[model samples]
Target: MDGRVPAALVEETGRWTFGVEPLPEAADTAARLRRVAGLVLALERPDPALDELLGALDRAERALSRRVPADPAPRVGPAADGDGRAYVDHSRHIGAFNACFPEYTIDVDGSRATGTVNFPVVYEGPPGLVHGGFLALFFDAAIQHHNCEVGEAGKTAGLELRYRRPTPLLTDLSFELTRTVEGTRIHSAGRLLSGDVVLCDARVDAARGQRSRLPAVSPRRVP
Candidate 1:
């Protein structure tokens, strides 16, 4: 192969978390949640009970919100140090809501990281293929997680992706990131693969600085 890359061993480490299945108890819960999400999206015919189910779920959500109105942003594994909740790392992340969160595992090794995930039937687009937007999301997250490894966490400044082949759903997918540091900026490239096939490629540029707004300083009187 001209530019082919070999697959890395998927290891369980403290640096990895998010949608993991290490703890048997947590894994069981995550599996159930993922299955429920799949059923919610895979159905073609509308079920009469869906409305009632939604109402019940809504009530439960409201009750939970009342109990714990706010929670710290979920972190990824033990490497996470940020205080706020990370929407991307949350157990019930946006992707998880669509049934994609619980299907992946990330491995961090210094300035590099790799992830393996399988998209279910619910993430289908363009026939039996995964949607382009979702692929982008994975790439973005993979690179961001890589940036976290070098203690230079930041927001993505720019991202570019190329679709080499249609990513098939319900198949094992691999994502890899190779990050480089250039002073305050982090450059990363990621690839999505299915076995020997390259499905998508992405490059991301991230700046290391204030990820959020800086606290305002009192104005000093000047003559």
Candidate 2:
């Protein structure tokens, strides 16, 4: 079983202990779907046939629902929680509803990890800038990716961010994450940049063996 979560390798530097792990692949379907979502977000003048297109999509959704009835949520035991195979690649799994993930590819090495993303219109909040929330999300994901590879799977306990400059939309931004471990916690620092210009910087604290909060409720079934 592919580790449901990511795993990291510890490196002995003769000075400090650190970790590095391979980056996850960007799934083809997830990438394409994100592009589709971007186009939808950028749409301006409505197409004359949009109504018909919506109707056809609705019919297709209903047909699919009939063929594949909803299944109960799978039960997870405590032992199963720590199994790497139980984790899913955050950047690749389309199941997470994160359409912006396909915008980046992460690189990892013995001491550090870096990611490059091209922000599209779908992530815009200000006139020409990427959304602040998305900036936080990117930093969180980057920090978690680093920890998941080197430490036990964990969740963010705290994040502190500073937006130095506006992160422009439809432009490439670079991010770097460096980590330090103290007992059961992982501390990471990163910067989001556009070439030499610093767009944002973040510090994150992650606690090992943590799980995210449960979903508030099941999503409304389609059709």
Name the top TM-score candidate.
Answer: 2
Clashing pairs in 2: 3-84, 3-85, 4-84, 4-85, 4-86, 4-87, 4-88, 5-87, 8-149
> Which whole-number lDDT from 0 to 100 does residue 218 have in model 2?
20
Which ranges of candidate 1 are over 4 A from the true structure? 1-33, 44-52, 68-103, 210-223
All models: lDDT? Answer: 0.62, 0.61
lDDT of 2 at 51: 69
Residue 50 local lDDT, model 2: 61
